[model samples]
Target: MSIRPTIETRKAVPTMEGAGVHLHRAFGFQDPSELDPFLLFDDFRNEVPEHYMRGFPWHPHRGIETITYVLNGTVEHGDSLGNTGTLGAGDVQWMTAGSGILHQEMPKGNAKGQMHGFQLWGNLPSAQKMTAPRYQDVQAKDIPEVIDDDGTVVRVIVGEFWGKTGPVDGIAADPQYLDISIPPGVKKTFRIDTYRRAFAYVFAGQGAFVDASAPSGVLLEKEVMGQEVNIRDMSGDRTLVRFGTGDEVTVQAGEEGVRFLLISGAPIEEPVAWHGPIVMNTQAELQQAMRDLRNGTFIKPAH
Candidate 1:
């Protein structure tokens, strides 16, 4: 029952991607090993249609998987493989860009001109990097939501939790993705696999992550259940919290309650050679991928 300590906390940086679409990047283009098997995460939430209408134009990706979860509005997507679909609110699309593929995602805001969603890039192991590309498109209704006795709600998007299993499966990283909401002033603890690298992205309201084992400098005293506990600062919107090795994570919601995404995956622990959307194990592989794109052969023939 060890509690995971908060190792680092930082706010997501505002960034523009995919033809001037505004978004916030929590982590990417840095030390890939820091959150092994997970390369990038972006919160593409926008209230202005002009900011996101351009969306992600046709792009090539390989050696990785892209998971797009939509909370509001809709996303229309098409791929070079001749597949087309529209993802509405609460829909999730998990695309495995094994070998290679070209795709385009165009977003359309909801009636109120609001669009919010997240995109997470997961790395594939070397053995599966050249596997056939596939897609797992799960609708919101298919995703299981569990409510605890204390009114804590958890939407299990991937992996098994609370006597339920997520719809998306056969993933390389074996990750667990959870969308959780805690009521105001409520405290909750979640169990995570100690062997996996885990992180939480706070996107709504505020909360303090309790870490009894945290160092002195970042520790703040707070009263929990009549006992004094050390916790980090109240994490608000777009905050990223990385946890140290442990099996449990405790968070106390603020007055407005808190909603966050808790994601964890088994570490790949392999050398990464990445450039733009393509991620490979070595520079030579990346170079070959670029050459393939130039030669109009990036998309392999389906078997």
Candidate 2:
């Protein structure tokens, strides 16, 4: 408990990627071991169509995985491996680029042409970098949702929770992705494996994440339908909150509630050589990957 000394403030920085798509990167390209297995997180939420409509055109990915979760729009995607589909609101798509693949994602906004989603890149180890490529698409209804009596809602995306397993599996990173929402004034503590490195991103609402006695991030109380309650500041839309060592995580919702993505996975802890969308363990290996792509041998024989 002492090791988990409460909150560690996350610095927010803006970075661009994928054909002029603007986003605020929570953490990436700085330290490789701090949050291993997971390399980058981009909050590509935009109300203006001009900022996001261009979408992610044809891009090559190797030695990594892309997890796309859409909240309020549709994303039509097609890959070099002969897979094509559209993911609407509440849909999750996990693309494992084991070897190399060319893919494109074009976003079609909601009724108001407003689109919002998050893409998380997971780096693969050197051994599995050239495995067969595949995808796991989970529809909104298929994702199991657990709701507590106290009004806490959790959507299990890629891990087992309350005797239910998520649709995506056999992943190289073995990550746990959960979308959690807690009502105002409810104190909840959930235990996560200490071995896994975890972080949370506040997307919608805010709340205080408490660590035992010390107050790490306190939620400013606000009124919710005449109830005197502290509300979490949702001002930081793409803010990344990295936690210290702790087996259990406790969160208290403010008056208007708190919504965030809780993710954890075993750290790769290996050296990372990242360039654009490709992530590998060695720089030479990355060069070889690019060469292989040009040689038309990136996609190997199917198992």
Candidate 2 residue-wise lDDT, 168-276, digit = tens: 8988778899999888667678767788888888887666665433433765655544544333422234557777777877776655677889898888778888887
Per-candidate clashes, comma-separated: 0, 10
List runs of model 1 lying over 4 Å from the truth.
213-232
Cα lDDT computed for each candidate against the true fold = 0.93, 0.80
Q: Candidate 1's C-alpha lDDT? A: 0.93
Residue 259 local lDDT, model 1: 100
Candidate 1, residues 1-303, lDDT tens digits: the string is: 899888888899999999889999999999999999899999999999999999999999999999999999999999999999999999999999999999999999999999999999999999999999999999999999999999999999999999989999999999999999999878889999999999999999988887544545756676644545455567899999989899989998877789999999999999999999999999999999999999999999999
Task: List RMSD in Å for every model shown.
Answer: 1.7, 3.2
Tell me the spans in candidate 2 whose CA falls farther than 4 Å from its real position.
1-4, 212-236
Q: Score candidate 2 by TM-score against the native.
A: 0.90
Evaluated at residue 57, the lDDT of candidate 2 is 98
- The TM-score of predicted model 1 comes to 0.96
